[model samples]
Target: MSATPADRIQLTGLRAQGRHGVYDFERARGQEFVVDAVLELDLTPAARTDDVADTVHYGELAERLVAVVAGEPVDLIETLADRLLAVCLADPRVDVATVTVHKPEAPVPHTFSDVAVTMTRRRAR
Candidate 1:
């Protein structure tokens, strides 16, 4: 994975219920999914102007991300991560967006901590 840029807006541990897995039961009974999003962009504008418009509105971002998790059913957390990344990248100011989706209550036979998938996307030149 690439290192995150110096100027970043980090939103972590966004919890939402989602029906996302391969099993039928998983799709029926939804489980909590946690998401983390890191956005890389120039913070100087916001810092200089001290204007919310100059930077990402994190509260709005959170709502949009939560909607995605609660909206549709998917087979894998990877796809979920991809969707989250897209949301972060929607802003024209964001140069890169990295997203991680965590399934703490994963249906694994063995004892484990968590199951997650992380993905990073950069704007196309």
Candidate 2:
């Protein structure tokens, strides 16, 4: 919807359960985390060919990201974000990745809307 590189794939609202937080209860009980990602690449080749293999497979990418979110424990969302970015950038076609990790069930005493972390990474030259 927004202005972005002509070539990109976006995935949003990917949910998974994981034990990640500073509080012990958070790790013990575990909670849901939502991940959003934008992968940037040259889509011209895929667009012209109309071939699935030529473009990033977002469905498969979602599965990998879910695995990271549902995997090992981490103390901060920043760590989770980095891990997701790695997964996105793993694809050779992806030139850059922007990731957002959301912790809805955060260990906050008062009511809050949400807690999230966003990060962006570029494939190494």
Assess each prediction's global lDDT (C-alpha) against the native: 0.91, 0.89
True lDDT of residue 87, candidate 2: 94
lDDT value for candidate 1?
A: 0.91
> Which digits, one per residue and each the tens of the lDDT, describe model 2 over residues 1-125?
12248777889899999999998998999999999999989887778899999888888998999899889999999999999999998988788899999998898889998999999998887
TM-score, one value per model: 0.95, 0.93
lDDT of 1 by residue, 18-70 (tens): 99999999999999999999999988888889999988999999999999999
Q: How far is candidate 2 from the true structure (C-alpha RMSD, Å)?
A: 3.1
Q: Candidate 2 has what TM-score?
A: 0.93
Question: 38, model 1: CA deviation in Å?
Answer: 0.5
lDDT of 2 at 124: 82
Scored by lDDT, model 2 comes in at 0.89
Off by over 4 Å in 1: 1-4
Error of 1 at 37 (Å): 0.5
Name the lDDT value of residue 62 in candidate 1. 98
